[model samples]
Target chain A: MVSIAEHTPAPGRAGGGRLAWAFVERQTNLWKRYWAWELVWLMYGVVNTLAITFIAKQVGNEGAASSINVSKLILFLLIGTLVWAYLSAVLDDISLVVTWERWEGTIEHTLMAPVPRALHLIGMSVFGVLHAVVRTLLIFAIAVPFFSIDFGGANWLTAAVVLAAGSFSIAGLAILAGVLPLLYPERGAQMSFMVQALVLLVSGVYYQVSVLPGWLQVFSYVSPATYILDGIRGGIIDGKSVADTWRTLAALGVFGTVLIPLGIVTFMVAEQWAKKTGKLKRQG
Target chain B: MLDELPLRAAGVAKTFGGGFDYGRLLPWRRDGHAPEPPRRVVDDVSFEIRRREIFGVIGANGSGKSTLIRIISTLLLPDAGEVRIFGLDVVRDTMRVRALINRVSADPSFFRNMNALENLLFFGKVYGLSGRDVREQSPRVLARLGLDWEQALEPMSHLSRGQQQKVAVARALLTSPVLMLLDEPTTGLDPRSKRDVQSFVREVREEHDATILLTTHDMEEAELLCDRIAFLSGGRIVAEGTPVELRRTIAAGRPLDEITMETVFMELTGRSVEEDEEPREVLAHG
Candidate 1:
């Protein structure tokens, strides 16, 4: 029999595009196998949204209904819950970049491969964004019917633009949080949830940032999710055009532009530290 | 270019467990206490490998064989020294160096849910192999290692340890890397699987334009496969030569055929390679 090594080609250099697409493809294959988990999360999001949005509908009084602006109240809760759901999903996916590999016992093999660090992450971020969008859209599809939502005046195109821009910053924050697991294997995974929780509270997932204490308002300004929630609400509820929410959109763009690179660099540094400290192989 | 000598290590050193005072965490700790001394894992070690040569590093557990392999594979950096692969510095040209090498660790990792073919294809793509090439090459490689093509479709979690190891070897070979780092490639294999892997290693050295740096504590395996062997004890290369040359180190004018590798190891390290008779306590140093 002919030897397999005879047909083997010389080792080739990894281009960022090909490697990134490979990562995307790998993630897609994984999702195909475990799509039930995604459906479960989608159902959970729908139930969570309905439970929160119905708070305004529960008060059975004309005076309370008029004072509450029940329609706007539901919209607020809808946007708040949906945006929070999307942002958290993206964060969770990207942050698990290392954790998933660790869980699968493939961290060393994957990390030691010849692919560029940026492409590896960009590919994962691409999958995260795509996965988050699909689940969020499904939740939205199942959700709008529960309420008499009026999309006739809603600027959905602007909302999508805001979501796209805002996703980059969330991607950056998730990459930063992902380094926590690489750095502190024992407690890092849980600590990442704390970071997400802080963002949830400060970004006004359920209430306006104005309602937060004076000190926390500073964090709200720093969190790109705040602008995402604001811009998305403006587009979907007020029917504001892209120009009307350009400032928030632009802020998100700037956040994505800066944080992505910053997050990558921070993660790389932490990775080096982990390897040096023999923490790379740590599994829980 | 950069193909004459496949591997070279110059005064490589790595240390662990120093820097901060962990003892101070105790409730009865006092001030002005110094931290524990750093333990050197790979202590000023250096060696070189020629192209297409199978060089083996033999040592007991915790002798820093894996650490040395990691340093050479560019997975871990040397604290104080240089490692060059094919005339390229492992640190300076890490990406290029990585492209030229592939490693098969003792316990290989893979996507458990994915079949062998899927894992191999994924790894192949990461190493810049085309999908078609991966598909064509994976089966043949697995067959050479005593694994059937049909069995390669099963999820890795369902496969036996030996079969998974064969898949790991297949994945490493799929890329046709210039240098192959095998960290105890046949450490826990059955006799047949061990012989299968050993035969594949010989075949790779003969057919592929590759240099093999293997680490193992198995004396017979090293003798049969490696062109030269280095006995690493306590993170240092205490003996280095071909099997015959190593045997002659303590031959004492006796016939060379009477000297076994075990005798050489016993005379050099004053301990049997077998684990049953050894003490259970592990020292801090590598």
Candidate 2:
């Protein structure tokens, strides 16, 4: 048959435009089969919104309000949960994709492609974020009336940018976790669990960073997760004037820029090391 | 069709790192990612593939066949080597290497949920194939592969293994690359699919003016396809020449009909290797 993957005409292939379009297309295809992940995240978003609303109600006793008070407790909880949910895979599943590919005996195939190795991993992360966004949108559509939220015009597009940048930064951490297997295959599974635990305990997913001890708080601030949460919280829930969130948005942007490049570079170095050491076949 | 050389690697040597050095022919001694060991995968390996030349890399597993192909395709760097495609260094000029080469490994991954056409469209954009051109051209490619046009819309998971392998080959062929790296492209195929893929390679070389670098463990495949054969053992070339010349070198005493590759292999290495035997373990190497 005629070749399916012929190099299309160029001028388009130069610079970020082509690569970004490639990634965006790949992510869309990836999300076609992501209904299960979508379902789980939707339920999780609901569960989190409900759980936080109850917790805040208890903090108020006979009607005491949150430190960050809001008349609609459910809306506040839902907004935070929906936005931060993008961090789940980064907080945990980065290594799992490799482990998953290794177990399936497919990573070798991925490596064989002429495309750079980092693109596939980053593509997976971008796809995961896209999947998360769909579920978050679904939850918003369903829960809007139940929570009686006035999500009207309080800077929704800015909220999306801040959340996306934050999540991508965390995905960089996830990508780093993913490359550990290529470098240290046997340690891969263990490291996956350890990273997930760290994200859970230290990233302040369930509680504020201040809740952790001082040293742990310092570590959390260093986490890409912290910037993600800070950006999302600052943009969506806080929804203060843009001037109020300038610092948080900037921090998220800086982390976003650094995270992807750092992760890809680490992946490249580890891949070079693995091939040299015959680790590809062993791990596969 | 290709009057000029498309890919060239001169004095190419790939070394294993860490613990084991597999190069027995070009032995050196050193450490820390340096080139002081003899377990060179492509020991001083030099060759030039002209455009449209179906150059094949044939050797036993661990004989550095795949390693050599990978290096040419810019997947791995050589320890003491230089690979240039139209004067572009595979190392210093990686983006160029990628643009010039389209590699189809033994296996390829596709989205399980998407049909063959969907996967093509996805990768089409990756190669910068976009818009109506991608949508219209996908089915034409699929049809050429003998896939039913309707199958383009079916989920990939429902397809047979042989069919999926075809998709992998199709993805590589889709790009019409200047240099094609086929690493055991037919390793898992049935005899028929194997022939189909082999024939496709031959066709592409003829029609597209592409240069092909293929690696395989099957001697029959090598004898049937490769223009020049290199007997690689222990990560170095023990012998390399045209099949007739190689057979003649070993046929000095034996009849031509009896001078199969097995005899030639045994004559050089003093060990008879068979495709059936699980081959040597990859041996943890540095």
Candidate 3:
């Protein structure tokens, strides 16, 4: 017989808060607990930078077209690689938080909070991208001395715009990825794998979009990373002015409008499905 | 009688299905076959939890006690009936309803790698509590739950299950949430920790004007802490009343003071939670 006098410790808002600064504080605290993850990320960045430098050298030696300027190409490739990392980092965190809640049975807490579920995902992605941005900046600081590379045209304004647009797109995709974790939770790796596949093949990561055949080129157009990488490359490497990169921003903004609504709707529907299916109740 | 009920539910039903149907085609599914008829997890559960009263809910495993809590918390939408929290429709005014309540489950997952302060601070922020308020009130809640402030910075994993559970209580109290849905809060605690928590809950209600809905299978917990209890069996409330009223009703000839809820549960359901003595450990897995 359980006695009220003898009983002990006890614990939901499924995402209910608005996109509040206070909510972001909740996310920031979560990020702090996993410091070892940051060190691992630093190692990943170093290995990744080395891998791109090696690959760019190979492309130069093999006489691949698109101008085999070794130093510039390596730097450009590294920049492109870092951008991909930044975007995926945001998406990864968003999806993983959903997965984490499912695994730990903590989603109920978030669901019960007085915030929208989308705000939680958006808040998570924003912080994740902020972490990635800071990490990329650190990598640049380290690379500048070791690799003896220039920071390209010092137009902080264009860099800022590109970064802003890039983060917005990644934030959008992060919500999309976050939705998949809620929808197809059993298919754990599938959500992240698809996000990575979209980044690696469709975006100009290892290869440029123009290099692809026409059929594959269509996919590149749809990828947010393609516009993001192209804009970054134009502004930083090619030293192209704002007029030249307007198309990239316009494309990204359009993608943002479509994805933002679609992502939110999909998430709401997926959560509704979860409620309808009693998945949240069952799991919690 | 129910004019100002904090929570009210009537004929609330929930069904589960659409599982693995993409591969195995549902016959009536919009995309394919609907597969099989969905099994009802929560079936026609009707009850009202009045404001500022501690309502105890007792049920066997798989009897939908947790599901009922989730539906009340607005984490779930019932298929058939309505739920209103603080006179607001749960479905139509979900955002407001959420603000009025917070649930604490059996195995509450605080950030495992974080310290007690960190998890509480994080949750305080989630409820839109100011940093100043969290900074001021967090230690107070922890202290009220018998947590040691000097050891507040230790990683949660290092804390005993009881201590961690205390932290969970502190976190829920951050909002001073009016309606607290506690699901088997003391399931794994040592006896002393259990006593501390139960007493703390009484204090919360007596001092803060809070209404509580606690789910448990412990007969003593229902008798001692709950003002009224509803015996749940197979997703239905078999019986409900004040502690004394319930005992008298269950055993008509027996003196109320001599009656036990375990006896009531046995008489009504033809089964008892104590019979399942396999001791379900609240295992902590990532």
Candidate 4:
């Protein structure tokens, strides 16, 4: 017989961290197996980035008399597209947590494992952020050559801070959306996609939030992406320092602090409801 | 001292469905439709398993076999009563209970695109085993269960259902759970694969000193592998005893050898082992 002593897990926090990493490793392996799908997504991301960035070039050419600097406009749209891509990737990965489990018919097995739900979610969030970073970097690298963008005055530190904060806040929102599939399996995944669409519309991924109608602009105040885009644009376009974007940074900080724990709590509550309602069972 | 026991469930019950219908408030003048009433899927069930014993709950489909298993596995909450695993409340000490138990369901649930070794390593790590330990142990477990290492390297979707089931069994055993919940582990296996799993289950109990709670509609399987059997009908245990004792309950002095499990099941539940009950909405809200 294999000795239980030999296989017994390390107790407490250390073990919890390992359990969380297990999800990351599992996701990596799954993605490796689904390389073709990843390739398709990457191709689509590149095409989408190029398509949006080219619009600035078209407007710059068509209206040479206008104040819009062709190179700066292209850079502005590029930043927006790339940031949206990263945010969308993170959101997609995190929000599909339940959907992926259901698709693989492993929802029960994964949930019933010895790991705490919090750690499991944290692991998933970590993977989502990492996966998003890599995919966004690739899209940025491929799309950069197509535009005459300048970065000599770019405030890299401020942009990094904003990106990190925005990722955390978006993770929380994704977790909230993730429970949709757990709560409504038949239409839950589509509901999550719709949540992402709403975020895109309100957050001004492709345009200025100020351009939105006053009623719609109110939502931009609540969206982490609004601050993310504004701060990133300020950093990359005008080279604003961290001190100049303190308000945006503070807002993102508040969002991250509040939404992450809120997401975890909501997920736990939804999990209990799923258990009670038998919604945890695998469904088509 | 209660912690020394392998499993204990007391007056456990679960019901599904029956909530206010918001759809009824829709504006269209329509025939009023009431919400479906709650159905007791597992009604006041209680059972215990001793250390290293193979206890079976045999029932047809929708008899609450899977629900009882889910409750014990800590995947679902009981509406009433308590389940204690090694004296830890399943609800309160869920993490600790989960550590002591692992389950295999009818579906060999997995990331179908990933190879068996990858899946096992992932599950093993979730249960706190290191990758190196899983790598060292999983091959041995798989080989013992009659799965080749080459086969274990193929994507799960590429493997036969029986092979995939073997991988599932290996994943459960990989954790070295003190209590193994096999919820119809052999339901879809081919005959040879079924025998492979059955023998492996017996081997696990004998060698690992693991207490097993298995549910199945396979009468012969229950008779062959279970030290004691409980006949479940409509979310309740209709009868429970050793195979011979269950047979003798309705034998009426007939030679014990002449009584088969099918006959005992027919006598006890008033239905054939092959019969399925009215399908309950297991996934519906309560």
Candidate 5:
């Protein structure tokens, strides 16, 4: 006869922050438990970054570098790789919110909890940003040693500001992608990755957006990644201040303002649809 | 005003996959074919459980027991009718209602790689309890359910099925929900584990003053644990009362003690406890 009242804390006792931190704690614990998977992903990111950066090295060594600054080329490609790594990590973490729950068969339990859905999404987004930041930093640290890169004039504050603004918009897109798995359990996760691939194709992860076809360039206009990359490149390689990249920062701001709310609303609507169609119980 | 009743459902109904096919509007998917009609999973069901009572809804698999539980748990919306927990509408006041209820499904859904204590701590925090509270209270809850603390510290995947089920129960109790929805809680457990869970459920109600709505196919388990029982067949309650009263309905003037739940189930639902209903395909999109 345990006295429940004596043991159970009142609901919403500490406020939404503490409640939201629960997800962060849970995800961290999960990462710890699956350290092997984290190591594998980290290794893959490292190799991918190196392979792309080596193209500049190859071009420089092949006597095609008399006119081009090989160091700047390396830095350009390195920024692209590192930024994409960070952005994609955020995208992957948030988009897999539903996939992870379903895989563990805990979607029902999680949905039935007393917390507001907004808090839940925010919590996951926060974890995504934090997790991506740490991983991206590690990738940067590892890749920098291999290149004789100059960072004497880099405006890191501008890059950081651009990244912060860009992450919100990416989180919004990830939330939208997450709705796919809630609605179509069997193929939704794969569908989410396809969305990421589309973003990659349109956003010029490793090349200039201007180099893409005119019609594809129209998509680049709407992609937050396009602005994010341009802003970061201007800040790091060209050493431009935030004031110099106001237009790019403004574009990301608009995206964040529109997409975050849109994503949350779409996700809520999809959740209702899932409930109506009995999709929540389906694990696949 | 209805807060005194821990649980209540009125004319609750749910149908899956009966609507116009919006997917057909797609250019590549314009095949002219009628959509499948919606199938009623829980039809016009109604019941109530008083505070501190262990109420059971007994039916075979696919008889809508789980669907009903889902509705009450706020995991699903009823197509028609309403459910209230502690005077809160499950639909309109879902978050508030959720604060008062917790559910245990047949599958002990958990993070397999994480240990049980970690999982419990996560769930507890979601319900607004601090991690320190969960850590301090979990050992006692686990011990009360006959689970060793060492076993709970191991990853959930390494634990046996029964042990996993116990962890599920422990997770639910950690929230200290006033209304406990146990959807086939003892399903797939060994007999001894089943008894342990059943006794713990009883102890929960007595000590915690909780109202419990449990769904099960095990008639004997229902008889042993439920204060009152409802016979659910084809998404409706066919008969409901105390065990003796339910048996007496089909007793035909014979001694009530001579009646078995199996006989009552057979007379009322026209099927054995082990029989399963025909499966139906539920469309994910309508």
Candidate 6:
């Protein structure tokens, strides 16, 4: 056997990209183990989108449906539900970062390693984005034929760009919410879900933001999901080009630019405080 | 030389509980509103480890040995005082200090779903090891700790407690840390596995020139592996010296062979090693 001394890595920092990919790999391995749960969530999303979007068809078939365009309403509901699915998936994945560590009982070991905090978090965010994308695409594929929607005029490329652009801001917000579990292990997971619920209510996942009361509109302005939902609806349901949706794209870019750094700094502060308070160890 | 000391801790302290909480004032107090005092888990502890020395801290469960190790390893910040690794302050030079240190504690956590090879490879990457290096080297380290290479390919959750402990040991050694902190690394291992880990620790120091600070409750294991041992009671070091020196100090002219490390510990702490733990619930009738 080779002496451990001979194989010791030289003292230095791990590559940021390699460490990030390792975290992504870790999540992928976890997905492989619990794929049944993943499929269950996928099935639940498909059922949910179908159930909600069919409301439009029911309304159109009503006796007072003289002015209802069943196809347009179905498209509207489909885009709303699908966009909500994608947005919520990203939020849940990012916010559960700390919860996942605690459940696995690996919080102490992972935090004690020599890697920088930013690299660790960014890696997790990268995984969250990729995982959410794959899961959302699967749901979309399953719902497409079931809904019987025509793909004739929808600007698919533009919708994809909008979804991608909105993801960064969602990642930032999720990172911020992830700090709750680190700070208050007992109620932190619930608190993170509450934050997600707030984003959902204010982001117009099922209705237009203008329909919200004036005070609630402030939250919608702050939520990147509002812009995301609007941009996605315009691209897919209204068949708008990227040039037409550039305002929402730019708004998302601005939110990402601001929130990512803010989230990182805030999470770091909370993490340092947790360490001083001895909260890094898994609490019963 | 002190300049090259692998570990130095001065007046390190960590207290648990006693922070202000509204819940404590919720009429559950025991008569007359007396609040619970903060328990100092690591109380004004001070120590230094010279380069390549294997230092042992012997204590019963809950004697603060693990807390002291955590403070030195930069896992938890000390409430007061400071720790330095290779003369770099643990708090201010945390990243550099972390690069120099690695720790193996009791019940070392891993990605249980992944095989030992996968877990080690992830940690190896965290320690900056290349993929090829981790794949080639981790198996050899596992074999040295008496874990079969084939068995290491199974999920860590499937391994025995002792086998998992060996994997933990192997993980720490994979980084070739300049200062290795073993907080009860073999506490729950079987005898054979214990000996495997013990001999592995010895070989690591000899071959890698790694300095080790080991905390354990096993008296014979301490005497066998530690160049010097410190007996801790109630979060304080009651005695510290070479094993033989500690035995002879209180031997009172008795035969040296008759005075064992257990006796030395009993003499210093006023309790047997088995009874050294601080009882949690004090019996009281009010």
What does candidate 5 score on TM? Answer: 0.95
Docking outcome class, model 6? acceptable
Reference-based TM-score, model 3: 0.89
Task: Return the TM-score for candidate 1, rounded to 2 decimals.
Answer: 0.92
Please provide, for model 2 over A106-169, each residue's C-alpha lDDT reduced to its tens digit, 9 standing for 90 to 100: 5654454445556666666766676666666776666556544555536665666667667767
Question: Scored by Cα lDDT, where does model 6 land?
Answer: 0.84
Compose the digit string of candidate 4's lDDT tens values, residues B1-286.
Answer: 2366778889999988776666677866236666677788998888888878899999999899999999888888999999998898998888888888999888999999999999998898888888898899988999999989999899999999999999999999988788899999998889999999999999999988788999999988998899999999989899988998998899897999998899999998998878888635544543
Off by over 4 Å in 6: A1-13, A63-68, B1-3, B22-36, B279-286
Model 5: per-residue Cα lDDT over A97-143, one tens digit each: 99999988899999889888888999999999999999999999888
Top candidate (DockQ): 5
- Comparing 1 with 5 on DockQ, the higher-scoring candidate is 5
The sequence of per-residue lDDT tens digits that candidate 6 reaches over residues B4-113 is 77888888878866677656567666457765556778877888888788999998888889878877877788999999887888888888777778888888788888
Tens-digit lDDT track for model 6 on A217-260?
A: 99999999999888888888789999999999999999999888
Q: What's the CA error at residue A263 for candidate 6, in Å? A: 1.3
Candidate 1 docking class: acceptable
* CA lDDT, candidate 6, residue A233: 82
Mind giving the per-residue lDDT tens digits that candidate 3 earns over B11-68? 8876666346675544445564445545566767788887678999998777778878
In candidate 2, clashing pairs total 22
* Better by DockQ, candidate 5 or 4: 5
Question: Which pairs clash in model 4?
Answer: none
lDDT score of residue B163 within candidate 4: 94
Q: Judged by TM-score relative to the true structure, which candidate is superior, 3 or 5?
A: 5
Write model 5 residue lDDT over B84-134, tens digit each, in one string: 887789989988788889998889999999999999999999998888989
